[model samples]
Target: MTEVTVLGAGIAGLAAALALRDRGVSVEIVEQAERLTEVGAGLQIAPNGTRVLRALGIDPPGPESRAVHLIDGPTGRSLIRMPLGPGFHLVHRADLIEALAARLGDIPLHLGRPVAGVSDGGRRLDFSNGQTRAVRRLIGADGARGASRHFVAPDHAARWTGQVAWRALVPVAGWPAEAQVHVGPGRHLVLYPLRDGRLLNVVAVEERAEWVAEGWSQEDDPQALRDAFANYAGPVREVLSRVERVHLWGLMDHGAVPAWRRGACTLIGDAAHPTLPFLAQGANLALEDAWTLAAAGDPAAWEAARRGRVTRALATAQANARNYHLTGMRRALGHGALRAVGAVAPRAMLRRYDWLYGHDVTV
Candidate 1:
């Protein structure tokens, strides 16, 4: 009988644990947090990612966004509109965690157990609490800086992207059942209604000259968020006015790790590659990784199936960061091109990204 140990009980970690358990493999998951107390926010579960969750018999409950619109910050006009794919939806971060937690069944979970280090060639996981565990196989979903990274990819480091992001949920009465990206010079604002349209999730990103801290849980003043985006459009300004709480973090890109496995241990999700939030595929890719890794059971094979696709996602996301912050000629060109797509061949344009929203990784 073989057993697998998973580090981190995050979206990725929990998904991996469930996938492995479904395959009749004994599995355990450990998390540093005493419990799943995720922040209040929203996440986009594109059809590609939601399919993975559904196949696992866990359906994430949330509101279905009708489409994603690229809105001009100054004109308040939509540059483009792409319908959310089948089953594509905006779910509260807390709601998603709760859904996944309910389906864990009998799998062993160790909370408040921080992994200290991994030693003896991926055979031992030393926890900070003076306890150690060994498993025939392991999945490194702890994070980019976790102990398991040493066994999988030792030389990789996260490079800050000279950008900072602010996240907040504001109470709003009536917002379109869609996600909107308000683009402007050097900054962009993404808004989507979550939790039955009771709260609007706002993620505002801007490029900065200096590097900020890297963690995601940093708190920032609401006034600071308002001051940073004071020049945004009317709707964005109104939404920001309703925001009383916010979380801020530096956008750091941990370029894909070239080495993700050693012995029976392998890395997944943020541990293997941490992409900036521009593409909104962090959770999606993590979900895909959970299914693909357990099904393949070979590190090289897993990479072969996933690395190219994720690299493409990372590139697309990076390109968004550039396109969203364009100023003069480039910005105009981008706006014209998108408008043309939206008018001339909307579905075709959507199909152009069939590789993304249409991708079904569970099969």
Candidate 2:
């Protein structure tokens, strides 16, 4: 009998399994996908997330990110370059997934088991193959659209954010090991290197009235992406011109779920709270959740302790979305203020996020 059954084999589920198993809890994983695919773009692992990986005895998966360079997208003018401390990494999503999955030794992983529905107050799982299993406890890491999330917050809904993001990879050699954010009016482009600086990851966002489908699998014409940021000059334009393929997804604001637990079941990661990409805390918070849940003696207490931090992080990300797309006078004022801050005390800019990157859950 499994003491805990984690849904989804993505970062959250796999990390939860490893954390629980390390604590001597009997754990198993259920994933709908037949096999883990290499279909993903790059992701940033902040120091907070990196601390968790190190606690789990896993090494950092990618090249250490040295800095974040903010730029003006239209003219390609550098606004500021904030240096990052130790433990920040720019990793491919597949590489991080593989890293977590590799440490899950001998843990029972059930793939190709799409959940049909969850019943019996979250203790019973019904799979699409007409199989039913009663679990002692359920950890819902199956993501926003998965059945585990539905079981925890049945009435929870997400609204489209009037924005869509395009993600792609372009081949580049000897790119700098830093993240660059090209901020424009109502749009922004983020670029960073991955896999020893051989591939440049691009995530371009634009405010749009039309709603495209959500999820990362939706493919759009590379020309559409190019057209969206046609005004961007310099290296930004040059990078977009080389894009051969891209994936597009509509950004949605699900906020935080009303409840993360119901009886023997609880939620983690995207199932509990879906965060915007602006803050890059989705995976980091998931890692924190996995470790905290395994270490907590009481689920309700854990939620209470975790809620305030998650709420703050979500709000920060939302603010960044607005700040990145500032227009007209606001853009001028914001950029000017940033430039002033960057000039006088550039290290102060990075120090502002000490509350975020400095946190250590394992300690």
State which candidate has the highest lDDT: 2
Relative to the true structure, candidate 2 reaches a TM of: 0.99
Provide the global lDDT of candidate 2 against the true structure.
Answer: 0.92
> Candidate 1 lDDT, tens digit per residue, 1-363?
348889888888999999999999899988888888866578898888889999999776887789888988867888988876567888987888788888899998889998888877777888898898777788889877788886677777788898999999898877778989998889889999987788889999988998878776889999988888787777788888888989988888888888788877889988888888988888898999999998887778988878889999999999889989888999899899999999986666567677888888777
Top TM-score: which candidate number? 2
Clashing residue pairs in all predictions, respectively, total: 0, 0
- Clashing pairs for model 2 are none
TM-score of each candidate structure, all chains considered together: 0.96, 0.99
In angstroms, the error of model 1 at 360 is 1.6
Question: How would you encode candidate 2's per-residue C-alpha lDDT over 1-363 as one tens digit per residue?
Answer: 889999999888988899999999999999999998897989999999999999888887999999999999998988988888899999998999999999988999998899988889889999998999999999999988889889888898898999999999999999999999999999999999999899999999999999888897999999999998989986888999999999999999999998899988899999999899998889999999999988894789999999999999999999999999999999999899889988888789888789999999998
Off by over 4 Å in 1: none
In candidate 1, position 219 carries an lDDT of 93
Model 1: lDDT of residue 5: 88
